[model samples]
Target: MARIPGRNPWLAWPAGIVCAAVVATLAWLALPMVPVVVAWVGESLRTATSPPVAAPVEPSRAPLLEIAESDDAIDCRRLYPDDLWVELAWRPEALLSQDFSAPSTSVASLTDALAPQVRVTCRWRFDGGGGISSTLARVASDSAAVVEAALQGEGFSCETAGAVLRCRRAQGGAVEEHAVSGDLWLSSVETGRVPEDYGARLAEGLWGAG
Candidate 1:
C-alpha cells in the first residue's frame, strides 16, 4: 500500500516569517507620524473645551478732585462775605433774627465719618419759619465721594464747576443746595421765599467764584 502524503511543517515557517516582516515594516513607517497625530488630537480637544474670552469693560467715571485733610473753620461772616447778605435780600439788622454755631469737637469731621460733625451752622429768619438754614462741614477725599453719591441718590442734580462739585434740588417751597470744595462741604436749605441764584451765590461765597 502507498503511504499517505504527509504535510511539510517547514512550508508554514516562510509564511509566518513573511507576515511578521510585513507587520514590522508597517509599524516602522507609521512611527514618525505618531507624535503629529497625538498633538493634533490634543489641540482639538483643548479648543473644544476652552472658555471664550471676555469683552473688555470700560471703567466708571467720577469727578476729579482733591479734598482737604484738615478741618476748615467756617463762620457765617466768612461764608457770606460782604454784599452777599444784601444780594440774598435778607434785611440788614432790624427784623431778621440770625443764629451761628460751630462744631464743639476740636478734630475735623469727615463728610461720612462715623461721628460726622459740621464746621459751622447758620440760620437767618425774617419771619416765623420764613428763613434759610446753612451748614459748612469738613470732609476727606473718600468721604467727599460718599457725599456726592448721597446727593445724587436723593435726586439732586450735580455738576462739576472747576474744582467744586455742586448739587441742588427743590420741592414745594423748599430749595436745597450742596457744594463741595477742597475739604469743605457747604449746604443750605431755604423755605418760604426762594432767592434768585441763591445756590450759586452761596457756593461762590464759600469757594470764591468757581
Candidate 2:
C-alpha cells in the first residue's frame, strides 16, 4: 500500500477540550460580575437624584405641667417672719369670684382662721400700698387672660418678674403652683402671705380634690 498523510487526532482532541473549559470558566466568573456592575450604576444614579435626609430634632429639658377642667382648687404654704408659716388656698371660684375679698381682708381672715390651730400669726404689710395696688391692677387686668393663654399654648404659665410660680391644672379638681416667690404681685386668694409656689400647689390640690 502507498504511504498517506494521517490526521493528528491526539493534538486535535486536546485543543478542543481546552477551548471549551476556558469558555465555561470565563462565563462563571462574568455572570456574578455583571450584576455587581449593574448595582453600582443604579446606586450612583440614586445618589445623584435623591434628596438628603433631614437631621433629627432635639427635645426640651424644661418640665411639663398640665391642668384639667375637673380641678377646682389648691392650697400652698410659705414661711414667714417669727417662725410663722402662712397657708393660702386657691380655688377657681375664688380666683374668678367677684365676691372674694381683697388681699387685705383675705390676709386678716386667713390669720384668724389658722391662728389657734396652727399657732401662727400673720400680718399684712401694705408697705408699697400704691405699688401693690398698681401691681394688683396690672395683674388683675392681665393675670387670668395671660394664664389661660399661656396654658392653652404652652401647657403652663410663668410670670418671672411678678411671681415665680408655674401654674398648671392637676389631675384632680384643682390647680397647682410650684416654686413660688413673694416679690411678685399676686392678689391674695386666701388670707396671709404665701410663696409663689403656694398658688401653684393650691391649684393642684383644689384640682385634685375637685
Which candidate has the top score in TM-score? Answer: 1
Best-performing candidate as measured by lDDT: 1
Measured with C-alpha atoms, the lDDT of residue 95 in candidate 1 is 41
Question: For every model in order, what is the number of clashing pairs?
Answer: 0, 37
Q: Write the per-residue lDDT of candidate 2 for residues 1-210, one digit (tens) a residue.
A: 553468577877899999999999999989979989999999999999999988898843222112111133212222121122222122111221122233332124322422211111122332222111100211222244444344445444444433244444332333333222222223322222234454433323322211
User: For every model shown, what is its TM-score relative to the native structure?
Assistant: 0.53, 0.25
Taking every candidate in turn, the Cα RMSD to the unseen true structure, in Å, is: 15.5, 16.0
Error of 2 at 77 (Å): 22
> Candidate 2: where is the Cα deviation over 4 Å?
1-24, 63-210
